[model samples]
Target: MSIISSTSHATSNTATLSQRLTAAIGASILGACLVYFAGFSHIEAVHNAAHDTRHSAAFPCH
Candidate 1:
């Protein structure tokens, strides 16, 4: 009985870990797509945004 319960518990933990991993992967892919689309849709806007950020940080973009 003890062995059976331990096995079951381990399987449950593995399933939970797998689900979390899948969710993380999905979120990363979605974020990448969003960034790609945003940059593609407005290349100049993105460039300006980065440029302003650099200037704000005093990076001497020129």
Candidate 2:
């Protein structure tokens, strides 16, 4: 009985971890898209800010 319960508990934890990981990846992709679009924005301030951010992160934008 204890073994069965422990197995179910582990499965539940794995599912929760997977869900969190998926959400984190989705959020990261969405944030990257926002930054990329902002870098190409017509607004000079937004474009500059994104460019600076990329440089600060050591991500070459050129």
Q: How many residue pairs clash in each candidate?
A: 0, 0
Candidate 2, residue 39: the lDDT equals 70
Off by over 4 Å in 2: 1-18
Tell me the whole-model lDDT of each prediction, alpha carbons only: 0.75, 0.84
lDDT for 15 in candidate 2 is 55
TM match of model 1 to true structure: 0.44
| 37 Cα displacement, candidate 2 (Å) | 2.3
Residue range 1-62, candidate 2, lDDT tens digits: 35554434444434588899999999999999997789779999999988888899999878
TM-score of each candidate? 0.44, 0.50
Tell me the lDDT of candidate 1. Answer: 0.75
